[model samples]
Target chain A: MTDVASPHTDPEQKRGLFETLEIDTRLLGMIGAFILICLAFTWYTDGRFLSARNIFNLTIQTVSVAIMATGMVFVIVMRHIDLSVGALLALCSAVMGLLQVRILPQYGIPLGSPLIAPIAMAAGILTGAAVGALNGWLVGYQGVPAFIVTLGGLLIWRNVGWYLTSGQTLGPLDPTFLKFGGSEGTLGVTLSWIIGALAAAAAVWAVWRARQVKERHEFPVKPIGAEVALSVVIAASILGFVYFLNSYLIPDARLKRMFEARGEVMPEGYTEGFGLPISVVVVIVVAIVMTIIALRTRFGRYIFAAGGNPDAAELSGINTRWLTVKVFALMGILCGLSAVIAQARLQNHTNDLGTLDELRVIAAAVIGGTALSGGVGTIYGAILGALIMQSLQSGMAMVGAEAPFQNIVVGVVLALAVWLDIQYRKRTGALK
Target chain B: MTIETKIDPRGTPLVEMRDISISFGGIRAVDHVSIDLFPGEVVGLLGHNGAGKSTLIKCLSGAYHADAGDIFINGEQAVINNPRDARGYNIETIYQTLALADNLDAASNLFLGRELVTPMGFVDDGAMEAETRKIMARLNPNFRKFKVPVAALSGGQRQSVAIARAVYFNARILIMDEPTAALGPHETQMVAELIQELKREGLGIFLIEHDIHAVMKLCDRAVVMKNGARVGTVNVAEVTDDDILGMIILGKKPPQAV
Candidate 1:
């Protein structure tokens, strides 16, 4: 570390190219873990795990939890636990299902109307926000510990889900409504390629902007070769993902055979690509927006400050109580979004919807580098954490692992990841 | 800097804490302590552990509210219920802990609660960094850790950040708790110089210090407290180190204390 109080006249002041770049070790660790997990699964499954179809499916599978995990990062960063998010998802889904199945039908709204989906989605989000407001009220104004309040919420909301549907599953939603989470309604091949190109451009621009800032400040910067190499690596991964998704053949032979047998002639020159899953698109958008909020917003900074030291933040004139309320509220809205996607993907709303999801969400946030002790986390990191968790589960399932065994392995990995994080922090003297 | 040939005529009192008293649980932490500060004056508050100097200052800084008594600014009663209220009165406190967020870089910590934002409500980090650079350059020319968290900085660098935060916010009345406690001799001299600059700009400062030499060097008046009561307040120019020591250790007021 450079001494801020002393002029740097030492010969060692100039660092190696890589060292000057100063990438976060935690983020690099996550990327490495993700790649290793992918390789292990690919090897174990004899290349099937890395098949274009499976990778596309894996991205979709990671969506719901990934979205919620993004919000959970903020919650944990502010040193608060929200164990009720899973139950909140169930309650939100139940409300949407009930509105679609029982309530809206009586109002002469056609079951097949496209309007029903948006209305039901809005209702579900509002319901989640309401419950979140209640949680915030109890924790902030009533001075109840968040753990106890959310623990009570975890039970109460699940029970509410049960009561809403009388313990029966609800669904067979409108086909249009279901498209959000289905593979058929994706960002098609050309769009996926276009998006990949745009993302690569943005990445390059970000690097260039960072270099300019460093130069303007007269700080040491990475060599141009190193910077270009880093950007190329990022860009290649993104474009490669688009190419892989585009290669996954949809309407496989079996489906085509069935259609032909039904006397439906295939259109001439017709071609289908897997494209990007709509749920994955939703997750990507959520991740990008949340990352911006976390990095560039006043509310984001306040979250970290309040988490770092509530007393200090308070003395600095932040209304920590209101901030707590706002954070929970945001988490609640995210739960609502997760609910919609999960319900669509499952094609039904079970009373047990989102059970044990809180654990997975928390694990993802922690694995992604969100510190349990607070004031340290990032939205992108948490999203990657979710991806890592889902990949492990997906890979293990492909290898014919039992559910019990999978649970144990995931639990160990979560612990091991946190232990690694602690060691890293210790080495860096950033543990405090 | 030219040493003053004689003390300039005292300006109107900028702040007055009249008969302020606060009790925590069953303990009277600060008991009816009255103190006044004038523009461009540095008042040194000296006390042993649990001597109520911090508790009394906390009341004026709005970290704690007084159970009994009143605070007046420029002869007008001021209501200070929280730290926000204190800042509203241009009263800034640099806590002993420095109170910086360890996870955030220097520029972020400097503008934590009161962030500079673009018209779009996004935090203008570039603008804020530019401002921080300008201030750091003026205050601590050697400071170059603007991109790193305060936790990674040296003690003196952290002190500079805390002091810069207080001074940058247009603080007219400053409460600095052990500002130089963690600094080296060079840093201490830098702070001393900073204090003189603030004095020349006509800001009032309350300095809580243990180092008697620092008190003699920086303070115009020194107030000694013991057992939650004021022992005396004396003009530093008229009091010997031994005389102030007697007031602190023996609870004996000097002839002018009345």
Candidate 2:
């Protein structure tokens, strides 16, 4: 009784008050299971095993998936699929790299060639958007299934990447170009802290605007206990989480120490600054921006509506076809952006770089509770799913597990995530 | 006392269905029928399911054009080539399903097709919320909630959103297909009140109701149909449940009521 009545236990000021009020059993169980698994992992890893640095590594690696999953949330919400992301990424990276070719100075603008790089990146994004449009059009107007169109797109775009790179590697992107990713070094604490603050502000703005509209209309709102407390808890958690990362958002000041031993640098030692990589920053931006788009826009609502019932949306005077096409195109653009991040971080472009990335992205999305049939996903869920996936993979590798074994584990995990999601939907009566 | 008008050449009709016939290939569903609706009046369309009642309404709404009949809206002889065209001609049809996107909230649903836009051309969600507040205020004071997704709303709320969608678009003629079919008694009363409110606004509503009690309670006049033919159009005061029942069974008016 004493334990249960802790001063913090008062529902009014309770942290994570939303979780307790939830009627969805599946969600409750998923959350509970997730907590249990995390605890188990922590216990197994022990004090040294679960350090801040290791957790940070897990987070940084999953950033790309987290970002792609944000866009996937919108697409999945509309009951559509965008399979061209991997290929789109490849194509974008290829173009980005090719534009950096001072080897062909005449066509490559200048050695520091500022205009050419921006144009190339823009061209890559547009190409991705165009492919997405084609996918959307085929599905929306031509009555083709999104799966088939995107699948065909995957092959075509990958081929284009190979053709553009002529089956070769493009490298040494300009330092400024790489800085967008953090390739220059771990981002300054100022940038990380600023980005985190902006995210919190954005979240608060959306919540406030939506609530005001509801209040003006006298709609039923969550009880005040849940509302105000949840807001404070959420805001505080964001602040604290960001502060924790800010304290160590960058790699250790001596991360390069491992690269050197006994007063001699290893053959592959001497990595860049102890700071966070630029790719990490790019991924963070992607996650924040895309999640905002998914949650706040009318376009986002349309995606859910269209996913729930296409015929009904059409009858409601919605240009369902237009929405479908637009989402497909947007998905492609995200993929392209992901590809650019990959290219910059890798410091080189290769057709093979993005292979199987789609599977991982899809797995992360579904694991995050993106319903296969659609109209049920969120950016946070997808990003978390990706983090979980990458964490498991990293943990396995650290335990001396082979890639094949890790692959099997991931496959099983994906299936379980999907099964759990279906169960969750059913309990919530959403499956109906 | 309600104000009403029929000056646009009752023959020309705001909507005309002439010899409009449709068949499912081997069967002649709507053999031959004609109906006309003019401005500022309620027109009830009734019949059993197989009697082609829905088929006829579908033709008018452009869901299905009569395989043989011609549809003209707003006199001047028009062609409702498609549902989009029906909308262009200010003809709106509300189905039993309400045809609403359940995941969207009320304001979004109300302005589903024709959303208000900001100066920069993005969907003006705030303006839409305000406009919805204004419209729903006059019709239903109870409808104040705007942001909760329709999926979480009650059945009556869903219906309200659908109706508001059509009304917000300046639809002059509304063809509601069994709007009250699946509602509970209290909900039916609420909807009936909504209909009266629409009527008070001077909108011509073609309410399709299966329940004779509902039709008598809410409609100013009623039209009965059987076997793809008009049983008759009669004032509510002039008919009873027995009359509508007889019309449904025998395709004829009841003796005393007639």
Candidate 1 — what's its lDDT?
0.86
- Each prediction's DockQ against the real complex: 0.41, 0.26
Q: Model 2's DockQ?
A: 0.26
Candidate 1, B41-103: lDDT as tens digits: 999999888999999999988889999988989768999999999999999999999998888
| Residue pairs clashing, model 2 | A181-A278, A181-A279, A182-A277, A182-A278, A183-A278, A186-A275, A186-A276, A217-B144
Alpha-carbon error at B206 in model 2, in Å? Answer: 2.3
lDDT of 2: 0.70
The number of residue pairs in model 2 that clash at the backbone is 8
Model 1 stretches astray by more than 4 angstroms: A1-14, A212-221, A252-264, B1-9
Clashing pairs in 1: none
